[model samples]
Target: MSALIDRFNRRIEYVRLSVTDRCDLRCTYCMPKGFKDFSEPDEWMSFDEIERVIAAFGRLGVHRLRITGGEPLVRKDLPKLVNRLYHLPGIEDLSLSTNATRLSKNADSLYQAGISRINVSLDSLKPDRFKSLTGGKLEKVLEGLMAAKNAGFSPIKINMVVMRGVNDDEVESMVEFCIKHHFTLRFIETMPMGETGQSASSQYLNLQTVKKQLARRYELIPGMMPGGGPARYVRVAGTDLRIGFITPISQHFCETCNRVRLSVEGTLYLCLGQEDKMELRSLLRNGITDYELERTLRQAIDLKPERHEFNEEPSKVVRFMSKTGG
Candidate 1:
């Protein structure tokens, strides 16, 4: 079987597939206020096209798939899509990243379909602050989280983007909450992606600092988790809950990047911090054969940059994180 190996010898075995760019919440960091520039429904790849793309990747030895979105659950008949991707040959694992606002209604179906793991974005536990940050009801997210847990999802992850003076004060409290619920916690450092992200750069708190503060309280023993993302994990001394730190700024993990992102419009993004990409939707719609699609994918992988210039060139990327898929 052929493998997607880049120039740097990084084997690309994972793909973060964005099913839709439409999200239910208007998070301040993700979607700008009054942001209306979304792709038309006709522009998105149909379910069959998406499946064919994944199968092509699967044949290239890409077994791990993560379904992302502005919020994946907002897409209609998502479980049906999940079921299709799960049965694709060579697919070893399937996961979803969501805001959990709609998980309450879709958790059972999604779990039964094939999603064995999930990553929920929850930045604040306070209702008012949650609404202020994400314009979402905290209770809805909480309910959705509980539903996901009850549906038998293992190693549920809570992704919290740590910002200075904004939600940094709740680090310990968030840890406590995760410990109580047996969910893994991950702290992320915000990057300058687009307009909103550039503005939010003021609140960019370094994860190294956050890790130091965490060490003052808990004995963080370094460990590894099953999911194939770029998070450095540590097991909390006394509990089963593991903590992960995703430091894209202070410590870029580009050297070990083994994944690429595919936008809903079928644009394959080679790097999160770089704009190098290739459009596959047109090729698919143009009646390109499966062999031709796989060749295009390999060509796309050849364009992957050695590393992103987020630190040196914070303004390099002008697209919103929502458009890039989580």
Candidate 2:
């Protein structure tokens, strides 16, 4: 089988597919208030189209698939999509990234449908502060997380975007909470993606500092985990819980980037920090053959940028992280 290789020889094996751009929460760092600009329902790739796209990638040796959204749980009948992709030939891994507000109700169905891993976005443990940062109820997210755990999801990851003045003080408490629950913890450094992201970049706290703080508390032994994303891992000396650092700013991991993002509108984003893209919806809707689709995908991958320019030009990309599928 042929593989998708870029000019830099990075083999593309993973794809972050956005099923929807609609999210329930108005997180200050993600979506701004009263943000009404959303893609039309018809504009999103239908379940069949999504399946075909993934199958095309699968035939080209892409085995890892991550379903993301503004919050993936908000999409209707998402488990149906999950089930379809789970059984696709050559697709070896399937995961979801959600805010966890709706997980309480959908966790069991999702787990049964074959989602092996989950990444929940939880920035604060304090109820009021959680609401202030994400305009979401902390209890709802907490309940959803417990439900996901009980449903038998292993290595459940808690993604905490550590900010300086906002929720940096809660890092220790967050780690304690993750340890108590046996969930893996990952710290993400905020990137200036769009207007909201640029505004939130003011609170950007370097992960190196956070790592130093963590080392002071626990012996962080360098470790590795099973996944295709760009998170560096460290195992806390005395526990099974692993901590991951996604330092896009203080440190960029673009050299090893092996994945690309596909927006809900069927646009393949070659790089998050760059606007290079290829429209696939029109080709799909116009009766493009599987062979043609695969060829188009290869053409798209050939244009993947070597690295993103987030540090050099913070405001270069103007689209929100929500629109970019987390």
Candidate 3:
């Protein structure tokens, strides 16, 4: 089968599927301090429906899948869904982007269910600072990370959203932690994907400046990860750890964007920064034929934005990142 190609000729091989939008923690930047904006239970796509959609995507040459959410682990019986997706015919890689709040309880089960890669979002190592940043105990995440390590997940990556003043001091300390544990560290530039609901916008901290210092401190050799996203990588000289930067604000990597996102509501977000989405829930439940499903997906690909516009004081063209499974 021919690959799902977007308007710009980028092969769409990866999909970030959000199982549920309900999260256990309220991160300061990610969600409002007292936010509880979760869709109704029935509104969520069922496991069967999710599998069928994934199967359709697999038929269209989508090979990599990342289970994401407000917090994927918060969804009950997630391993069941993970097990199903892992056995999909054309799926080459299965992973999850999580906060690790519940990884300790489920990491072994997730690994047994065929998920071998994981990305944990941890902004600060200081317990007090972490509590202030994410409104959750850092100790739980630490325990979960240890569980992931014990479960034998390879190449665990820690994602740190760098803000100019908040937790930015932890950059070196976070790097030190990753180096000590032999984990990949990725510093992401906080994006204005949407307004305060999506996330509280702050002064973005470009990783290039940090990269310069790190380069001066150690040899920075360019490298790549196994799958998905456009974050560039640099090896840490003589160690197995690699430092990564997901700079949506400082550097645009959309030209090479090769993935689409599926929101919990079954909307296909062609670009992370755009609101253009195609509703697929009705089609899936209406018993749409495989041919029709493929047609709808291809049409959605045609609508994928060339790039995101995030330069203004507040980018007015995007949805809440939580709604889109960021």
lDDT of each: 0.94, 0.93, 0.86
Instruction: Give TM-scores for every candidate, taking all chains together and pairing residue i with residue i.
Output: 0.99, 0.99, 0.96
Stronger candidate by lDDT (1 vs 3): 1
Off by over 4 Å in 1: none
Per-residue alpha-carbon lDDT of candidate 2 for residues 181-300, written as tens digits (9 for 90 to 100): 999999999989899989987899999999999899899999999999899999999899899999989889999999999999999999999999999999999999999999999999
For model 2, the stretches where C-alpha displacement exceeds 4 angstroms are: none
Clashes of 1: 0
* Residue 271 lDDT in candidate 3: 81
TM-score of 1: 0.99
Score residue 236 of candidate 2 by CA lDDT.
93
Tens-digit lDDT track of model 1 for 1-326: 58999999999999999999989898887889878899987999899999999999999999999999988887889999999999999899999999999999999999999999999999999999999998889999999999999999988999999999899999999999999999999999998999999999999999999999999999999999997899999999989989999999998999999999999999999999999999999999999999999999999999999999999999999999989977
Clashing pairs in 3: none
The top-ranked prediction according to lDDT is 1
Winner of 2 and 3 under lDDT? 2
Candidate 1, lDDT over the whole model: 0.94
| Position 141, candidate 1: lDDT | 97
For candidate 3, lDDT tens digit of each residue in 38-110?
7987889999888988998999999999999989998889999999999999998999999999999999999
